[model samples]
Target: MNDITPADSAERRRRVARAIQRRMVAHVAAGGTTDFASGPLENDPAAYTDPARAELERREIFLKVPLVAGLSRAVPRPGDSLLFEEFGQSIVIVRGRDGVLRAFLNMCTHRGTKLVRAGADGTCERRGRMTCPFHAWTFELDGSLVGVPGRQGFEGIDMSRRNLIQVPVAEWNGIVFVRAAAGSDELDIPAYLGAFAPELAQLELADAAPIRSSSLAADCNWKCALDTYGEGYHFATLHASTIGVSHYGNVAVFDDFGPHWRINFPDRRVKALVGLPESEWPEADYGGVHFLFPNTVVVVGSGGPGGAFVRMFRIFPGQTPGTMSCRIEVYALRGVRADGDRAGEFAQDDAESDVTREDYRVAVDGYANLVSAPAGFTVVYGRNELALQSLHRHIARAIGVPL
Candidate 1:
């Protein structure tokens, strides 16, 4: 983990502010518009409808790649724990009493019963000691099987050899990452982030706590739901009644950070920073949307009159190719108390859900149409949707398939 001091945090914010100012200036100089890609990109329709390819992705990408299991705040205390089911694998992320975080299969070492079960929305509270409900088997937070009922029946059984299976886990910039498959190499979060590390570190996510989380089932592929967020092209037409009123249409700054990408969409408020000095410009005047490689999208914006907030979207493949699950987590700066904070948080949550529902509605319709589309059908991603193009390319490369 990188030790980021106050000076480092301030410097990162200043750097981002300067970069945005430069882009704004260049946009004005070039006739008040953002740049565009050379041409549109095309993707095969089967990439979203193929069951065989989805299974391969489940093994190669979902299992092998480091996925954002949850935020650091999900297990803030030493005894805090949570269960995550991704790609059909049950994972338990826990913070041990030694102040270390670890991941393991959420199963009893004796007889393989699930150690814990998530609530309706796939979330649960911390458990100091995990006990399998099926049998009287108990285990510690660090996946050490300490007690087993009916031990006399299993004579000469080595307890040390029967510890719960451990999965590779790491925390970076307040995000928890896990690799579910056994014997997989440790996921180096920093190395994987590459040049984006410094920028992501600037978000100061560790200084925030998750305020609310909710999930919705979508009648579309996981990628289809994710594609809705990779571009702002639909804001004017699809979101005209909601976000489109406050945000500009089809105007954004795009940049690549390794396999990840970021799209900065300036709201009507961004015009206020046009002539201001770089030092005086607000750090988060624009909506900063970051697409973490593979599955997560982090959207950062101002929290009303004070503080800041972030909304993270994690999309996972469902039981079939035509279904997907989307989880949204909203977080705010820790220790920042103000009047009507709860009201403000609830308002934000409602507003986000309203806009997200619109996106999903369109995506679901698109998916249904694609399933019945004629042969040789292909989806075209306009130049304005470069992020989608890049994301599809990475997915194809990971699954060894052609887009």
Candidate 2:
């Protein structure tokens, strides 16, 4: 792991990009990881197969820590919201008329049925208020109860106390995060982000717009499926026919800010930068996958410089340790989406989908084995798989477990 501290500056990005390019070009020449000394760690198979441990992670990590809801740009205007139904609970992350983002338990104040039904894309369309599908109870974007049907029938019902219950919500850079449990002061995202804050800002996510979105369901542990996104070692065997053809396999650059990281499997085209002067190197294709701690991946698409894009992957644990779901949201800078020259329009929808399918196919099959693997077998992360190692390590520390 070339654990360069993640920096917030454009110069740092430029420098880091060039350095990674140079390093990757050399690795392409050497055909293996040689710069870092970190190594293969065996993790207990029980971690992925144990319901007891999965429940612990659910309580400590998923519910306690702030989880990614969606992009801020998805709800850029007042009264916009999306249903974030994960962990068997429904919640709505909404924006108010006063331009503040708030989250509410999706239950109606009257009968406890879901008040908002999201469209096929997980977004809700409302001018400023949402009425319950069951009782026609109305709520403002800020979750204040405004109107009630049959008010006289239900006499002495205090509307003030019937407001929608609120949970904590925060917007950092362009990412919107929510804590399932109710709390106000604890969701300091910037503080939680720590050194990763500046690196996230460089993506300019707040100014971007959502283009497309999709979801994946897999029969594997959530962390097992998530590990697929943290390393490039599998490209040679697993993605050989896809990403392997265009990008070098088993080679990458790693940088970290606490548990968060930026790991890139460089473009083979970067080999052109090997002997050339650094000043003459083009800055158009310097990109990497940024891993937000716990469960989110922001792939800063390197489809040339001006036409920037990002793909976000948010994974959620299922009821059992052997099942999980993932949400994939694609976004691009506002103007770039409208530009005629936007890059990889087909690649985003087709090629990336193919790659994700390949990843989960293996994860599900491997998980099947782990489920029955002798209560003692282990999963190994190779010497070069630094990001995966750090990820599991952080999860263990967070849940008070020994990895």
All candidates' lDDT scores? 0.81, 0.80
TM-score of each: 0.93, 0.92
lDDT of 2 by residue, 1-403 (tens): 1123334445676766777777777776665553342678889988888999998998888888788898787787888887789754688888888888888899898989999887875677866788898889999888889888889977887779899988888887778888887544458887778898777776667777777888889999998889999888788789898888888777888887898988888767867766777679776454688988889998886554356677889998898999899999887754445344354654555788899999999999999999888756789888788888889899999989999
Best by lDDT: 1
Candidate 1's C-alpha lDDT? 0.81
TM-score of predicted structure 1: 0.93
Top candidate on TM-score is 1
Candidate 1 lDDT by residue in tens digits, 5-29: 8578867776775687578555654
**Candidate 1: residue 121 Cα off by (Å):** 7.8
Which 10 consecutive residues of model 1 have the lowest summed lDDT? 24-33
Where is model 1 more than 4 Å wrong at Cα? 25-32, 119-123, 272-287, 334-336
